[model samples]
Target: MKEKTIDYVLRATWMAVSKMYNEEAGKAGSTMATGFALLSIDPEKGTPSTSLGPKMGMEATSLSRILRTMEDKGIIVRKRNPEDGRSVLINLTNFGLEMRNFSKGVVLRFDEAVKENVSEEDLRTFIEVAHTIMELINNKKIYKPETSAK
Candidate 1:
């Protein structure tokens, strides 16, 4: 493992970013996942509980636990979705709105700081590389048919 691979860099960078966000969230007595959830919910109209999992790329049990904690903290409330009687919508409370604003500011500041440091050309190239990697994975190009088994 003398030389690093692309996945290593991606994982390490993401881990660092996650840690930084968690630290920032700790100040407000929250976690990065909660902050993410707060941002994922629609500001005006509430978001469906079922959709939250897919939107956040989280699991049902995890989302349910976070939602329960948020509700207990008075940050959000669950109400019946008008359009779908069987579904429930998660609405942010006034405090949740304030928290969401705070979370947004943190993210904006992070983006601004990163943009200030990275040149536009480098940033564009980085984005293109990332997209290419995603495309490769999405199209199942990495692991293919037996044609390349040699």
Candidate 2:
């Protein structure tokens, strides 16, 4: 099989999984994850949208809108940075933490589903390929040719 074919298969599989998982997740899934990601980083220090957007590959404007929604829902709190008054810091509220925990359970159930559906060998291969893809895309690294031992 060609490398491009492998990429296509990987993308298709990802789409399928994501679609199913998102359906299961409903409105709570994506928003919950965003809130959880913010909480997971620095509870006390909090996270700035400026930093979080680029890291998540989300646009600042879009992130702001999401933040607004989360804020209205009481999922997160926005505080002014005392030192840097211009900066906005985001933190998860107790309600947000509970939602994040619920999302965790949903993700765990999805993991079990994936494990049951995909064989061990496939799962191993998928993990290696997924990590390679992440390293290539997120880490901006290239894949080097592996040398075989004689």
Whose TM-score is greatest here? 1
Candidate 1 scores a C-alpha RMSD against the true structure in Å of: 3.0
Angstrom error of the Cα, residue 110, model 1: value is: 0.7
Query: On residues 24-122, what C-alpha lDDT tens digit does candidate 1 reach at each position?
Result: 988999989899999999979999999999999999999999999999999999999999999999999999999899899889999999999999999
Q: What is the C-alpha RMSD of each candidate to the true structure, in Å?
A: 3.0, 7.0
Query: How do the predictions measure up, each by TM-score?
Result: 0.92, 0.67
CA displacement after TM-score superposition, residue 34 of candidate 1 (Å)? 0.4
The superposed Cα distance between candidate 1 and the true structure at residue 37, in angstroms, equals 0.4
lDDT of each: 0.94, 0.71
| Model 1 ranges with Cα > 4 A deviation | 144-150
| Residue 124 lDDT, candidate 1, scale 0-100 | 95
Which residue ranges in model 2 land beyond 4 Å of their true spot? Answer: 1-4, 27-45, 117-121, 135-150
TM-score between model 2 and native: 0.67
Query: Against the hidden true structure, what lDDT does model 1 obtain?
Result: 0.94
**The candidate that achieves the highest lDDT relative to the unseen native structure:** 1
